[model samples]
Target: MELFFKYLQYEKRFSPHTITSYQTDLCQFQEYLKEVYDLEDISQADHAIIRSWVVTLVQKDLDSRTIHRKIASLRSFFRFLVQQGKLERNPTLRIKAPKLAKKLPAFIEEDAFTQLLDQSEFSADYKGFRERLILELLYGTGMRLAELTNLKLADIHLASSTLKVLGKGNKERILPLNTSLATSLSQYLVKRQEAFPNNNSPFLFVTDKEAPLYPKYVYRVVKKYMSSVSTAVKNSPHVLRHSFATHLLNRGADLGAIKDLLGHASLAATQVYTHNSIEKLKAVFEKAHPKA
Candidate 1:
């Protein structure tokens, strides 16, 4: 497992969050194997043992997506074992993953988001300034929460209306900002400086203590304002991001261009936005079409 960790950290260059997930999943599988079947060695794990563990996960009522992730961790570990000549074959290869439903990504309406930023009042202080910028950057740039957290003071190029985002897998992409987002960013910087005169934190967003905002703090901040502005079934920072892409597509933004802006790796990943657009079109057609 240490060797696997080294490979993931040094060779694969996976992020800490991802490495932790892999570690937890692998450890759970090993504990299950030892307790259930008295199988101490994971190297002897085969198709039947792997399948049984999956069945137990289903019986435990875990989310299908979560089960899929656990299986993926096992598969990766097995592949690594094979590469090191410790195993003849990977057993997870023969197992079938449970079928998953294609759930549409939830998004806030343009009017709702517009009202949130324009009409709603934030406190006339540093926290308010920081919170507003958090919402603006997520919705404006269509960046993920982790990307926003990892953002640095130098990443914002306001003069050019752009941001250099380091996204998943440490891949860097350029995202353009609108006049409104650029304006909000500019405002936040001045207040941030006044709020923390001696603070040398390199993070773009920070707590009152001048420390970088953690995932949960950011979640609470976005969730609170999101609840105020929209009644979407889900209210998270990513909802704002989805709203960004969906609204862009509805306004005739090209799919490929939206893909690039959202930092999607492939067109297939980008096509999901089209489904949201189609649903909107259907609702409009039902109301306005002559032939009902």
Candidate 2:
């Protein structure tokens, strides 16, 4: 199991958070096997045993998406074992998780973002500059929270107006930064240096204590600012990302271009934003058409 974890960490290049979730799911399954079937080795478990565990997850009334993720973990673990010759066959081949409902990704309206960024008044201090930059980058680049947190000072190329984002699986992609966002980023750097004159931190975004930015800090800043402009239930960083993609698509950006900017591994992942665009079109049609 430890070797498999190392494989995921070193070979797969999955983020620590993802690796921890996989570990949690596998450990829970191991405990279930120990308590219910007296099984010692997960490699020896058959498809029937794996299905039974999934059944228990369903009985717990877990969300279908959560159950599906757990099942996916089992599938990946068993597949790795088979490749390593620890098991003859994968035990999760027959295991099926409940189907997930098709829900469109939630995004704040473009006018809300315009109000948040253009009309809002942020302080002139370092903290305010940092907060403004966080919103600009998330909504401008469509970067994931992990990607944003992992960003370093070296990733920004202000002269070229581009950003190098290290995405999932350690894939690096260069995103074009608009001139306005580039100017904002450049100004933030000045404020950052002014705030921490003698301190040396390699990260682009940092706490007031001169440490690298963390998830919760970014979330709090985003939630606080977005609340004033958006009434959406989810006023989070991801909503900003969704707004970025949806707004671009609504303005006639190509699907493939948005996919590359968003760092999606497949077109299917990028297609979700199109649903939001379609919903917007439906709203316009209902409001403007002659027929009721």
In order, the Cα lDDT scores of the candidates are: 0.90, 0.91
Report the lDDT of model 1 for residue 104.
87
- Show model 2 residue runs off by greater than 4 Å: 118-121
Residue 185 of model 1: what lDDT? 91
Summarize candidate 2's per-residue lDDT along 156-221 as a digit string, tens digits.
999899989999899999999998899999999999888898877888988888888999999999
Candidate 1 per-residue C-alpha lDDT over 1-292 given as tens digits, one digit per residue, 9 for 90 to 100: 8899889988998877899999999999999999998988888888999999999999998988899999999999999999999999999998887887688889988899888877778999998998889988899889999899999999989889888998767789999888888989999999999999899988998898888889898889888888887887769888988999999999999999999988888999989999999999999999999996
Off by more than 4 A, model 1? none
lDDT comparing candidate 1 with the true structure:
0.90
Cα RMSDs of all predictions? 1.4, 1.6
